[model samples]
Target: MEQSFLAYLRGRTRSLPSVAVGIGDDAAVLDFPINGQPTAVANEPGSGVLQQVACTDQIIDGVDFCSESQPLASIGYKSIAINLSDIAAMGATPTAALVTLALPAHNATEIAGEVYEGILEACGQFGVAIAGGDLSTYDGPLSINVTLLGTVTDPWLRSGAKEGDAIFVTGSLGGSLAGRHLRPIPRIELATRLRQIATVNAAIDISDGFSLDLDRMLAASRVGAELDIENIPISEAAQEMSQTSGRTPLEHAWSDGEDFELIFTVGESDAIKLEQLSADELTTAITRVGTVVGRTGLWKRVPGSKLQRVFPQGYVHGETDE
Candidate 1:
């Protein structure tokens, strides 16, 4: 339904000339003019002007969190952190955010204050300023929305992936719902350091399940992937969740959403350079999980078993896996 609705919107909506990227990748990049001069062309290297990157996300009570049990501040932090993750995925520097709140009529003032405390905490940690937004008391559950703005000279796009590229993911995957989902550590510094060290062909954040988000990148790049089951990093939380969930830790790593890690592709030489880096140097553990293939489907290689096609399973808002 999300894809079909997005397709419908794409069919009807016409993008303006200034829109560098619209409704496709992590964020919408716009080629805003700088001092009467147009910014460098989209996807081109060595652009003097910074392209504007914008993204917005919302989290609601009950759906994103249990308002009764969880701290309101954490919920607010998550609202901004998710958008920051989007900005980090674009390899951009987040500058500011506009926060909007939909508060319940009961204890609205106290709830708003607590949520703002979380929002402010995240913004302070990330060096983002709250620009402006709207607030309203409604008859519904608490909801928080954040619109993040950033700038980038050379944006890493999903379509940039090519055949023979080595796929890598920062940090472990799966079982973020154990409590880490609310306090996401956006890889802004890591992404910047990565660009400085090597050429990143394509990049994306694992907001949904790893398989689903990786599939989205592959679809954009018009390529396929062959993953090694053993190489995929399964988190400790995933292991714990697997015990009673009747699924393997790997299955949780593959399809569990809200990991917020980064999955990227690089060339063979660059991949070697990245792999050689110690954990202390990168400040994050990155694993080489797969290789980009020429075909157009996701495949996994299991030990002793033949290569098998795998469905991209993950969180699909308002829809179930078919």
Candidate 2:
């Protein structure tokens, strides 16, 4: 579905010269030129030529949340957080956000206010502002959409990964639906600092399960990955949730969606530096889970076991129940 849409857009729109990065990346990057001369701005102390980046994301009431039990503010917060995660994947500093809400019939004004409160709280945390938005009425479910804009001096991309790079994930994975999904942090600060200290090759936020998002990064880079099963950081929530469930903790880490953590690749030397920095005062905890391989499919190797190809496809919209 995404591919078809991109294909259609590609046919209609011409890739202009000012568009540094286009569709299929985490966000679209556009260069700002002042009166025909390129305007350069420094987002970091010594970095140069920061360009504008933008991305949009949306969520529906029943599809993305339970309106009955979940707080209204949490719904609003998640809407913004998910979009900011995309900007974070580009290693950009978010500047502003525009929101659009489709309110269902009979929804109260106070409920909508609370949702805006949550949205503002998240924006304040990341130092971004609500630039503009639209509100409309709908007969069906409530929906929240957000468009995030930002700037990056050196944008990290999914296609920058090389075969010899090492794979890493910030924080834990899986079981995000255990309350974490409602208020997951965007990792914006951590990404900014991580890129300063280590060379990030490829990056993507794990929104549609770890395995699927990792496969996306690999596909964009035209490379493969070999994960160390023992090394993948499975969240404690995933472990506890798996105690009586049919799926194992590792399986949940691979396939449970909405983790919103950053899975990135870097050089082996940078990986070692990242491990050492994580020990000292790194903002976010990172775990080395895999290495980029020359092959063309995702593989996994448990301790004392041979590498085996695996297809741990994660969540996809429009999938019918069997």
Best by TM-score: 1
Q: Would you estimate the TM-scores of all the predictions?
A: 0.95, 0.92
Residue 45, candidate 2: alpha-carbon lDDT: 18
- In Å, residue 195's CA in model 2 sits off its true spot by 1.9
RMSD of each: 1.9, 3.2
Best by lDDT: 1
lDDT at 26 for candidate 2? 82
Query: What's model 2's lDDT at 161?
Result: 82
List clash counts for every candidate, in order.
0, 0
lDDT of 2 by residue, 154-185 (tens): 78888878998999998898889889999998
